[model samples]
Structure formats: structure tokens, C-alpha cells
Target: MMRSSVRGFSLVELLVSVAILGLLASIAMPVVELTQKRQREANLREALRSIRHAIDAYKDASDHHRIAVDNGASGYPPSLLDLSSGVTDLNSPDGPKLYFIRRIPRDPMNGDISVDAIKSWGLRSFASPYDAPRSGNDVFDVYSTSTEVGLNGIPYSEW
Candidate 1:
């Protein structure tokens, strides 16, 4: 038989490798968190935009007399559901139903799609003060219910 030699990682080398991996993981964690925050912020923007657009459309229809609206009431929809549930056409009582949005998008900050979308959002009625938004008789505006500060250094609710 001839002498044979085999090489394997020494304890020091293995420890160094683990240390490097730990360092890399530490550096990567914040980046991953930031990326997720940005994604959620984008989703929040899209959700707000969609809901706002639907509210605007409802108001427009009400203003144009295309949809029946209560006298002395703001043209805004009474509830977000009203947009998706369909509204009656004032032009013809028997006309096809008018719908604004097919479905209400969930609040991205909450990330709870199972919950009611209306509950997930902070609603502002036309009668509510802009500085202190609150859901009331109608849905004039929508904001994220999250109090978390975004990566942009602004409160998610302010966005």
C-alpha cells in the first residue's frame, strides 16, 4: 500500500466561512426589508388611486344626473361598496345598472385581504375635516390606516 493524503477544511477556515456568511446575511436583511416596504408602498398608492378614481366617477355621475343621488347630500358614494354593488341610472329607471369598480382593493399596509376592504382603509367623508379624516356618511377620500413611517420618511397614513 502507498501513503495517501486528503485535504479538508480546517476548523479556522470553516469558522471564517460561517462568519462571512453571517456578515453577508446581516447586510442583506435590511435590503430585503427595504425592498418589501417599497413594494407595499407602491401597492398602497395603486389601491388609493383606484379607490379615489371610483369615488370621483361616482361623484361625476351624480353631478351629471346620470345617477340618482339624495338631495342636499354630497355627490360622493355613501359607501365603497356602492361603487361595486351597482347604482341605478337616473336617465332611465329601467336602464342597465351602472357600476364603478368591479371590486375594492385591499389596503396593502394591512396585508389582510380576508378582512373587509372598507375596514382596512381610513375613510374621509366630504363633511370631515381634511386634517382629521374620519369615515362617516360618505366616502370622499381614502388613506392607509397604517401608522408606520415609510422608507420615504413619511407616515403611511399621510400618503
Candidate 2:
């Protein structure tokens, strides 16, 4: 007696294969989410650092009389725009413009793409308290406007 040979996988075999694939996909979902979060966090850190450094550079330039300052000015940029838009250099002949960061970076933690990148950040002026950031005459520092907590358990605003 001769038995028929199956040319392809049986129904049970296909079902088992699908189940295994589904299981793997489910298992990978959380890891993919975690990786995405980590990447966003890293981006947040870099954006903060770059903006902060630009602020510092602007301040240093002001302190050294490189950038023109008005009477009673805090030596900080009047706005985040100044960092990217550039400032008139007082020290340079013919007043060449000085630029800090090429452009203001969007806050990675801020999910609102509708808002402008500059507006997405919480600005602090020199007059504002360190613990309580507020916008005033000049932009002294920037923080994420997002209130969400990071994977590190620290609020994005505080980061």
C-alpha cells in the first residue's frame, strides 16, 4: 500500500508557525518601544546641551564685549532667536555678525509638532529664579516644556 505524500506544510504546522511568529512579534514590541524611548531621551539630552552651550557662548561673548550690549543688559541673548539669527559683533571691524547655534533645536520630549520649536522650550531669563524658570527680558536657559517623566524617573522639564 502507498500513502500520499504531502507537498506542503500541514494545517497544524502552519498554525504553529503563525503562533510562534505572533509570539515573537509581541515579545519584540516592548523592546522596540524601550529603544525608541531611549533614542528620544538621547536626542533630548543633545538638544539641551547644544542650546545650553550656545547660551553660554553668547553670554561669554557679551561678558568679553564681543557682542554689543545695551545699558543694564543681562548679557544673555534677548531671545532664543538671537542665538540662531546672530548678533552684531562689537569687536569685529565693520561689525560682523556672530552666531551661536545654527538653529534652535526642537524639544524631543515635546510631542506637539504644531508648536514652533522655540516655543516648545521653556525659556528662563537671567532675572528668573533657577528653580522656577520664567521668560523675561532675555533668554538665559531653556528646558523642555513637557511634563512627562523620563525613563530615568526625572521629569523632562527638569532634565
- What TM-score, over all chains together, does every model reach? 0.91, 0.94
Per-candidate count of clashing residue pairs (backbone under 3 Å) = 0, 0
> How many times do residue backbones clash in model 1?
0
What are the per-residue Cα lDDT tens digits for candidate 2 across 1-159?
A: 999886998899999999999999999999999999999999999999999999999999999999878899999999999999988888774766999999999999888899999999999999999899999999988999888899999999998
Model 2 TM-score (2 dp): 0.94
**For residues 13-119, what per-residue lDDT tens digits would candidate 1 score against the true structure?**
99999999999999999999989888988999899899999999999999999987788889899998998999999888897889999899889898666778878
Count clashing residue pairs in model 2. 0
Q: Local distance difference test, per candidate?
A: 0.90, 0.93
